[model samples]
Target: MTYTFDIIGVTPIPKFVQFQHQFAKKPDRSKTYLGSYECSLDGLISATKMIPHKPNWDWDQVLEEIINFWVQSEESIQHWKKQLYTVREESLLVARVANSEALRQEFETLWQE
Candidate 1:
């Protein structure tokens, strides 16, 4: 199973930063599990405007560092549970904003101003 979260509007650009954590079996015959992760950014831009894609941070490097640390660190069920909660919270926040008609109108108004 994979867990996903999005951090929206945390940067200058109007974009959704998606984070995914993937799980799979290790290549060795140890019958152990391993994790791989990835992140993507989708911009919420106006159709009339064209802007080059850029991010201030090195997202790939940050993701690599985080995954490396997670894989190397000793973890228990509690740690994973905490991570699940974090994912849930971020996911909920994204959902809330995406589903809010009022928020959408507000952004539209701001953009038109």
Candidate 2:
């Protein structure tokens, strides 16, 4: 289930900015949420990048492609959404020292610019 997206990037992407504003400093949030959101956006961008610069694909195909993307993902967002469900299981009430350490390391390495 683990993947490359699990690791923070060396440079923060544009989506990460919005992710921070909405999900970063909130009662219901975690690095996994940000990571999942980033991956989802990345998938969209990556998909679009595959198309030729011109109108290689019609509008309907593009829309179909977008819908197919999530449908193809058997796991869907449940992987992360479920994590958000059980606040206790997610360690929402307590400080996750280990996770914080990893997240800090991620920010330091990724946001250095």
Candidate 3:
């Protein structure tokens, strides 16, 4: 079964970031699992924004880089249990893009002040 990523609880402040892996075909809430990676708001913004600029990189490679970033930044890599967390490359890419765009808007407002 295919799976996708869902980003939740994102805020303007640097706080705990939570994401989930869920069956793509099934929208049921019960079919999903949650996972978290400790990262600063800046790190999250940078990683998600930077990946899209590399035109040569494929989605799989991009996903690998993101996974590596999470692992390296987190002290306990065990949190990334395979069964609970799986990255659907495209879904993550889309989520990151959307996230970055929202961040961009937020930042623009701050900058304009």
- Stretches of candidate 2 exceeding 4 Å from the true structure: 1-37, 41-52, 76-113
For 14-74, candidate 2 gives per-residue lDDT tens digits of: 5544544454444322233222223353444343433222222244444454455446654
For model 3, name the residue pairs that clash: none
Model 1 CA lDDT for position 41: 18
TM-score of each: 0.23, 0.24, 0.24
- lDDT of prediction 2: 0.36
Candidate 3 CA-lDDT value: 0.34
Residue pairs with backbone overlap in model 2: none
TM-score, predicted candidate 3 vs. hidden true structure: 0.24
Cα deviation of 83 in candidate 3 (Å)? 16
What ranking of all candidate models by lDDT puts the best one first? Answer: 2, 3, 1
How displaced is residue 108 in candidate 3, in Å? Answer: 2.0
lDDT (Cα atoms) of all candidates against the true structure: 0.27, 0.36, 0.34
Candidate 2 to truth, TM: 0.24
Clashing pairs in 1: none
The segments of candidate 3 whose C-alpha lies over 4 angstroms from its true place after superposition are 1-62, 79-102
